[model samples]
Target: MDIQYVDTYELTRAGQEVHGQAPIDQFERLIEDLPEQADTMVSWTVKGEMDSFGQRFLRVHVKAAPMLECQRCMKPFEWPVDSHNRLEVVNSEAALNVDDAADADPDDAIIERILGSQRLDVLALVEDEIILSLPYVPKHDVCTLLSEPLEEEPDGDLARPSPFAVLGQLKKD
Candidate 1:
């Protein structure tokens, strides 16, 4: 689908929906945030409608794998993202202020301040949701062995003892 920008008013008013699967390269911001190069695809489904509160909303579900640097190993790891997000379309500055007041933490729900245009950036929305779905610190459950251990080698070299071990030896003496 050619999801450059969508007409929000018409989409919400008519209660329309859009769905597609696209490569992760399509998401520029998401790619920039990753530490290593990624090769993955993101699938999304966006539905536009007015809720019972008479508020325009876009419900979205996105699935993808983002490449992230492991905190422990500093190696690139792929993290699968499958998340759902809801955004309330706020039409004006006044509407946005009211919505902002209603929820101090915008993360309570995403608010889209339409800033003089009915055009909604579908790519950004999908990107933001995927970013939010990711962990603050991405790491592998078990890292691969990438280097030699801290223990002394079998060639008769003495290993550096721990500070606590030296202190204990002093106490024994």
Candidate 2:
């Protein structure tokens, strides 16, 4: 879903209304399709306002379900993702670049881009949040039903060596 600058401006003036589900395919950059899992559904509401810098700012609250694979068991899992993001729309590229350089935190990179753009792409923002929030390695806890049971060693005793241990002693003679 391409968000146009004009649409954002209109939203700021007349209060934008957001609802319904957004297809995971809309965020092709952030995620790829897998054979085992289904697409994600994102639902959100975005409220826009003018910030102190006279830039348009939007606050988005999103809820989604992302399908992922469990790193340990290689099983598929559906995880719930909910997050809130704040975005600022700037009027010029130079100001956006300046804001990015001044912002020290790596987490704020998306915000900087939004601030630089004349248009606010809410779908892109949601995609960024989803990718950032995903775990590097997904695993189920020990208590989970999917967890594998540990194997026990036989006889509960350590094995001993043979009597031929003395054969090395005779070799020197």
Candidate 3:
């Protein structure tokens, strides 16, 4: 089914938990965002919470495997994607725009200001996370073509110049 939006405020307020699996095919933008796709689906679980400061928070865990085209050999490969996110829901974007926003602690949960009646486009969020998880240049760890191609020799043996021949001439001189 199509997952467009969710009432994040209510879910967070009631401390609700949401978990489900959906086919990635529903996400058109997500389908084309990466180089390729393997027949797969995205599974996710979102849990609500309230911090000591009475701030609404949501923890999201997503898992998926997207087919990726190897940049080194142009071969299709599956890239397992598992992402976890913790978000704090704020009343306004002003909180997110504060000067210290950029300096927020990495270990701290990311702050997400409420948007449009506290409704969240969950699918969009998943798509974004998937995109961020993609490798800049997808490639296999060990590519088969790393070594140079073997050159064809004349027959069983091929003779050329010898280093000793030049040394022999020098010795004669």
Candidate 4:
């Protein structure tokens, strides 16, 4: 299947919007992170606009629930991914680097910069967003390991005596 490509600059200049739904398998890089090939689909919408400063920008939104392995329990769980990004289209990479350096606080900077391209890979962009949205250590709020019933220990000699038992014996003596 052919991956989707868009002319980012033109899309922003024309104020166009495109939306699509694609199977998770289509994202090659994202597939590597998944535990299995889930029957999941990712839905995305890209809207282009010119900001108040006449700067071209693309607003990308993506939503998907992919099965990811939990780091703590080592079990597969559905990870909900919803990401929204505003990409400022820069004429050159130099401009992007300059802006990045000038932004003192990344937390305060809401808009991200990307080099404007005539044929920007849309799937790649979506895949990048999905990966960014994922947690560094994917884990459930409550790991399943804690809920699983532990095997019952055998009683009698197999069970080790408690440390305080010696103190109890001394007290009795």
Please tell me which predicted candidate would have the highest lDDT against the true structure: 4
Residues 1-173, candidate 1: write the lDDT tens digits.
56757778877888999876667887888878677656556777788879787778777888777788888888887776768777777778787656455655656644554432467777787888888888888777566655444555576445665434533432331
Model 2 C-alpha lDDT per residue in residues 1-173, reported as the tens digit of each score? 33423356766555565544566656676567422445445666677677555667667776666666777666676665667777666666666667454655676665633543345566776777777777777664442455457556476433643223322222222
Query: Higher TM-score: candidate 1 or 4?
Result: 4
Runs of candidate 3 with Cα error greater than 4 angstroms are: 1-3, 33-36, 101-106, 109-117, 147-173
Prediction 4 TM-score vs. true: 0.77
Question: Judged by TM-score relative to the true structure, which candidate is superior, 1 or 3?
Answer: 3
RMSD of each: 15.2, 19.4, 18.4, 16.8
- Local accuracy by lDDT, each model: 0.71, 0.59, 0.68, 0.79
Model 2: weakest 10-residue lDDT segment is: 163-172
Q: What TM-score does candidate 2 get on C-alpha atoms?
A: 0.60
Candidate 4 colliding pairs: none
Shift of residue 87 alpha carbon in model 2, Å: 1.0
Tell me the deviation in Å of residue 162 in model 1.
41
Q: Each model's TM-score?
A: 0.70, 0.60, 0.72, 0.77
- Residue-level lDDT of model 4, residues 26-50, one tens digit each, is 8889879679966767888899999
